[model samples]
Target: MVQAEPETAACMALRDELLGPLRKQTLSTEKLCEVGRLFCGAPERMSLYGVAAPHMEAGGVRVRGRTAVECTIDEYAGEAADAVALYAGNLREGSESDPLVVDLFCGSGNLGHHLGRRLGRRVHASELDPQVYETARDNLSRVGSGVEVEHTDYRHLIARLGARTENDVYVVEPPWGDAVGAVGLDLTRTTPPVADILADILRARAGKSCVVVTKTTTETVCDSLRNAFRGAAHLCSFAPSAPGAGVEFHIFRLGATDQP
Candidate 1:
C-alpha cells in the first residue's frame, strides 16, 4: 500500500550485494605489510604505509613553493576525518537523502572517497598540483564517481561552486603552505596556516554554512586566525589521545550573513 522510494530500493540492493560483504571481511594490515615486503624485496615496505609511501611511490619531489619543508604523505587529517564521520552520522537518519559534498585541496582524494562511499552522493574534488591532482582522480575513481575531479586552486573555488549549486555541504582542506605573513619578507617555522583560505571563503560566500577543517600548529598563526575569524573558529586538538596523530587542527563554521 505504501510507495517505496527509488533511491532507497537501489541503496538496499547495493548494501545487500556489495557493502555488506565488505563490512564482514576485515582487511589485515599485517598481511598487506607482508605482501608489500615480498613485492618490493624490502621488509621496510610495510612501515612505508604510514605518511610517506604514496608520494614516494609516485616519484614526486617537492616542487614550486612547497619544497622548503620535507614532504609527508598527504594523509587525511584526523579532524577532517572526524568531520566526515560526523557528516556520516547525520546521514543515518534518512537513507535516501544524500547531500552534495565538495572537497577542496583534495590531495590523493582519500577523504572524498570515504565521503562519497559513505553518503552515496556525487563527490567533487579539486587539487592544485598536477601530480597530486592525477592521484586524486585515480583514487576517487575507486569510489564509482568518475571524471568528477577537477584540477584547480582554491582561489577559484567560489566560481566552481556557483556552477554546481547543488553542492550544499563543503569539506575543504586548503593548502597550509605558508605561515601568516611568511610569503616574501616574513618567514616563520609554522607549517600551514588556515586563516587566509578561510578569509577568502568568507569573502566569497558569507551566507552559506560551510564546514572547514584546517591542520596547523603555529601559535602566532593560530592567534592571528582566532582574532580574525572570531566566533567562527574552534581549536580541535587531538594530541592528548592520539599522540602520533597530527598537529592541533582548527574547525570553523562560517556564520550566516546577508552578504553574498
Candidate 2:
C-alpha cells in the first residue's frame, strides 16, 4: 500500500479533527459536504479553520474564522447584506450620507463588515458570546475603520445608543433554535424571542428608520411583525442552496410604509 504524503496526511488529520464533532450532530449530508470542503483548500487556509491560524473570508474579503463552521457565512452573508442595503435605501428617501447601521447579533461580524464596506456607514455591532466576540473584533478590524464590534449584549448596546435618527437601520440575525441542527416553525423558540424585542425595535426606529431581521422561515413570523409594528412590514423568502439544507431565511422588514 502506498503511504500518503506529509501534507496530505496533515490535511486528512485536520479534516477528521474538525468534522468529528460535526458528524455527531444532526447535520445533513449537504452540510457535511460543505464542511468537508474547508479542509480541501490550501494547507494554510485549512489551518485557519483547523488550527489557530487567524483568518476568515466572505464575499471575497478576508475575515477571521475561528472554526470550520464560521466559514459557512461566506456562502450566504453577501446576499443578505445586499438585501439590507436595498431596504435601507428604500426606507430613507434621498439621504445624502450613509445611515447608521447597527447589527444586533453580529456573528463573526460578516453582515456588519459587509455593510460597513458596501455602504460606507458607521456600523455598531455586538455579540453576546465572548469567544465569538473576539473573532468578530478581529474580522471587523481587517475591514477598515468606522466599524465597531463590542463584546456586549444587543439590548444593552441599544440602550446605550439611546434615541436613533431617521437614518438609523438595525439588523438582527438571531439563533433560530436551541441547537445547531434544530428546526421549527415558531419564531418564539429563537433565543431572545423576536417578540421580546419588537416594541423596543419599533420605538428605536425613526420615521425613516428600518429594521431588518433574518430568521428561519415560519408561517407566523409575518403576522407577528404586522401585529407588533403598525408600519409597513414585508417578508420575503430565501431559498436554500441545497434540497435538504433545511435552512431558509425569511427577511422581515418594518418601518418606512410609504416607500415604493
Candidate 3:
C-alpha cells in the first residue's frame, strides 16, 4: 500500500468541506474575500495539491436571487481577458514610448495592472466603488508604481487621460451585470448601455491610436461600434457551449485611425 502524502490530511479535509452540499448561504463579495484569505493561508502543501486559491484575495463574493457565487480576483468580466488580449495585440503594437493607456471602469485595476507590466508604461484606471476602487489602487500600486487610479465614474476617466497624452492607449472593461453584481452594478434600469459608453470613449479619444476592449453578450455592441466608427473595428466572438446558457462573450476592439 502506498503511503499517503503528508498533505493528504488537510487536502482531504478541504475537499470534504468544499464539496459538502454548498452550505454558505450568506454570500457577498466581502464574505468571499474572507474565505479567500483563509484559504490562501492554508498550509502551502495543501494549496499546492488541489485546493486552488485566488491570485489576489477575492474582492468579494456576489449573491443574487437564491444562488450564490464566489468572485475571484480576475473573475470580473473582461477584466483579465481584455488586458491580456490587448497586451498581445494593439497594446504591443505601440512602443512603450507612446502615450499612456487608460482602463475605464478598471475594477481592481486588473486590466491596467497587466497592461503596465506588458508595455512597461503607466496604466491609468478609473473606478467608482469605494471598496473595489481601493482594492484596485493597492494592486496597481505594486504592479506599476506609475499607475494612476482615480476613484470616480468611468465617464470622467477620459478627461484625466486626455491630460496625460504622452502615449494614449485606452483599454476598458465596462460592467455588464452577470448573475453576480461583482462590479457594484445596478441592474435596475440599464441607463447607459455598453455601446453608448463605447461611443463616448471613441469621441473622447479625439483621434489617437487607442485600443478599446469591451465584454458583452450581444452582437449589438459590435454593430453599434461599427456604425459609430465606420467599419474601423476588430471583433472576436465566443460562446460557452454548456447546457442552458444562451448568451455569448464578445471582445470588440476599436483602434485609433490616426496616432496623435
Candidate 4:
C-alpha cells in the first residue's frame, strides 16, 4: 500500500483556500480528500481508491457514525455477499458438527447480521464503543438467528472464545479511523494492527481449519498481513464491482498447511 499524500497543516490550508475552513463542513473526509486530490495534482475522476485521496482537513474529520456507515455501505455492500459465498464454498469442501461466524470488530452488526441471516450460522460479534454496541445489538437481535454481541474490546472477546473447531470462520473489519496517508491505508495503523488481530485468532483456533474474511481497500498495503498469513489473501467483491470503489475484502484460508 502507498502512503496517502500528507494532509498536514499546510496542505489543509490549500484545501481551505478553495472550500473555506470557517464554514461547518458538510463533506465527508473522503469527499474532502478527493477534492484535496484534485488540487494536490491528481485530476482524474475518482472513486477514492483508483487514486488515493492523499489529503485531509482538520475541521472536517468525523469521529464515527451513520455517515461513515452510509458511505461504507455504498462502497462495499457487495463484500458481505462475497463472504457468504466464501463460507458456503468452505462448507462444501468440509464438514463441521457446528460451525460459527465471528466478527472481531463489528461496528453496527452489518457483517454479522448478513452472515447469520444468509448462512444460518451462529454469529458472534463484539463492538468496543457503547453507542455503536447498542446499535449492533439492536440490529443483530432482529435477525433471529442467535447472533451474540458483546460490548467490549476485541482482545477481551478473543480471550473468552475458548477452543475452536476446524471450521470456525473469523471476520475482521477494524475501525480505519478518519485518516488515509499519502499512498493508501496502512493495515498497521488500524486500531490494533490487523496482523496482530489475525495472529491472535489463528492462535486461538490452534492450527485448525481457519478462514479470515477481512475488510481491505484497493490501495491497502499488506507486508505485515502477508508475513502473518504466510499466504496471499484473495481479493473478492460484489457482482458488478468497481475496482477503485474504495472498499475491498481479502479472504485467507490458513490452517494445517501454514508456516510458523
Candidate 5:
C-alpha cells in the first residue's frame, strides 16, 4: 500500500465524514471550508483538499495522495466499462490471433483493470505522472493477472512497443479537459492534445484495431477523427444516464474495415 501525503490524508479524512450520509447534499462554500479546515489545517490548503470530496464520493474508494487529486475518481462508470468490454469482445470474436490490450492513458488503471478482468487478456497500462503511476501500478497489481503498469509517457511506450501488429488493440481515453464540465471541440485544449498524437496513435496501430474513447461537449473531435481515418472510422455517442450528468462518451473505432 502506498502512503498518502499529509494533505491527501487530510482530504481523505474529510471524504469519510462527508461522503456517506451527506453525499447527496450540497454543502455551502463556508461550511465545506470549515469541514475541510479540520484536517487540512489552513484555509488555502482546505480549498485544495476540498476538491477531492466530489471525486472521492464518486469513485467510492481511497487511493494514494497525488492520484486522488490528479485523476478522476469514477470516470470509468459501470456502463462505460461495459461498453468498452463489449466492443473488445466484438472485435476479438472469431479472431485467430491473441490480442493485446494497451491502455495508453491509464490514470489510476480503472479502465485497464476492468478490461483486464473482463477480457482476461494481457493488459499493458501506463500513466505519465510518477505518483499517479505508482497508484496505478499498486492498484493493477492487486488484480493478479497479466496486467502490467508502467510509469512512462504514452509516446515512449508506443515507441518501445514498436509497430502494431494484427490483433493488437489500443484503447485511449486521454484527459479531455481539467474540469468535469463540457470539453469543447478544440482537441488542442486537452492535456496531450489528441490532434498532436492522433497520427502517431494511428501509425502505431496501423495494421491493427484501435479505439479512442473520450468525452466531449461538441462533435468537433469526432469530425477531426473522421477526417483523419476516412471511411475506416466509426463514431458513436452515449447519452448521459442521468439528467444532470454530462453526455457520457464519444467512441471512435478505427481499422475495422480490414478486420476479418
Candidate 6:
C-alpha cells in the first residue's frame, strides 16, 4: 500500500521475466579490465556489474571536482538522485523540518550532494572509509553543498536518525563483491547483507513509513531481492533494456504513505 506500487510492480515484472537471459548473456571483460586498470578494487568488481572509473560516464571526464574517486554508475546515479529527491519531496508524512535524505556507504558525496540539491532538502551521508569520509567532508564543505558527511557506521546512523520521522529517504549501493555477483546481484552476499540492513531499518522505524532506494545491476536476480525485501518497488532506468548502460533501483517502502 505504498505510494507507487502498481508502477513499481510493472518494473519488477519486466526485470523478473528478463533476468534469466540477462544472466546468461556474456559479460564483456573489456569494461571490467578498463575499470580494474583505472581503479584497484575487489576482483568481483571487475565485472560488467561492477563500479565505473568516474561514474560521470557520458558527459565528460573532469566530473566537476567529483572525479574517478566516487564509485557509482553515473547514468543510474543521476536518475536515482532525481528520483529520490522527487520521491522524498512528495512524501505525505513530511515534517516541519523537511525529511532527511541519507546515503549509505556514501563514497565522496557526489551522489548525496546531487540528491540534496535536487530534493531541496537536508541530506546526510555516511562513509566508513576514513579517507573517503575526509574527502567528502572537505569537498562538500568547499562547495557548500549543505550535506552533513558523517564518518560512522550505517547501523548507528540508522538507529540515530531512523526514528519514526515524518519523511526520510535512504540511498544504498553497497560494494559489488559482497553485494553483486558475476551473473547477478545477491542481497544475502552484500556485506552485512541487505536484509540485515533492512531489518535494522524496520526495527528502528517501529512500523513508521520510510523509503530505501538501493542501486543494483541490470543482472540483479529478482528472486533474491523479492525474498530479502518483500513489497519493495522497482525503478528501471535503462537496465533491463540497455543493460550495461544503466542500472536498476529497488525502492523499499516501510508502509503506506501516499505521495502529494
Q: Which candidate has the top score in TM-score?
A: 6
For model 1, how does the per-residue alpha-carbon lDDT over 99-214 read when each residue is reduced to its tens digit? Answer: 44667666545555555555556666677777666644654454344226788876686554642222244555544433323221111222223445555665666455455544
What digit string (tens of lDDT, one per residue) describes model 4 on residues 1-260? 11123335654554444334422234455554544354333423212211223222242222132322222331243356456566535433225546667888776455665565556666788887775676556544543435689998877786688445555667788766543444556788777777678777767766565667766655555554456456534434332153334445666765563335
- lDDT values of the candidates? 0.42, 0.51, 0.44, 0.53, 0.52, 0.55
**Candidate 6 ranges beyond 4 A from true positions:** 1-70, 89-97, 164-166, 233-243, 256-260
Query: Candidate 6 lDDT, tens digit per residue, 1-260?
Result: 00111224443443333233332222234433333333333223322112343332321212211223235533445666666655554633244646767887776566666677667666777778665577557656756775798999987887788654546777776654545544667777887678777777777677566778776655666677777776555432333222233356666665555545
Candidate 4 lands at a TM-score of 0.63
| Candidate 3, RMSD to the unseen true structure | 10.7
Q: How many pairs collide in each candidate, listed in order?
A: 1, 1, 9, 10, 0, 0
lDDT of 2 by residue, 93-187 (tens): 33554346788887656656656656666788878877667655765565454568888988877777754455466766665434232123455
Q: What lDDT does candidate 6 reach at residue 97?
A: 48
Model 5's TM-score against the true structure: 0.62
Judging by lDDT, tell me the better candidate of 3 and 4: 4
Screening candidate 1 with a backbone cut-off below 3 angstroms (N, C-alpha, C), the clashing residue pairs are 51-73
TM-score of each: 0.54, 0.62, 0.53, 0.63, 0.62, 0.65
What candidate 4 gets wrong by more than 4 Å, as runs, is 1-75, 87-96, 142-146, 222-225, 231-244, 257-260
Show model 3 residue runs off by greater than 4 Å: 1-97, 142-146, 163-168, 178-191, 207-209, 217-230, 235-256
* Leading candidate by lDDT: 6
Candidate 1 segments exceeding 4 Å error: 1-79, 87-98, 142-147, 163-167, 178-193, 218-222, 233-241, 257-260
Q: Which pairs of residues have clashing backbones in candidate 6? A: none
Q: Using lDDT as the measure, what is the rank order of every candidate, best first?
A: 6, 4, 5, 2, 3, 1
Worst 10-residue lDDT window, candidate 1: 62-71
Q: What would the per-residue lDDT of candidate 5 be over residues 100-146, giving only the tens digit for each residue?
A: 67778876666566565566666787788675676557555653545
TM-score of 6: 0.65
TM-score between model 1 and native: 0.54
Given candidate 2, what's the lDDT at residue 18?
43
Model 4, residue pairs in steric clash: 1-221, 2-183, 2-184, 3-182, 3-183, 4-181, 4-182, 4-183, 4-184, 5-182
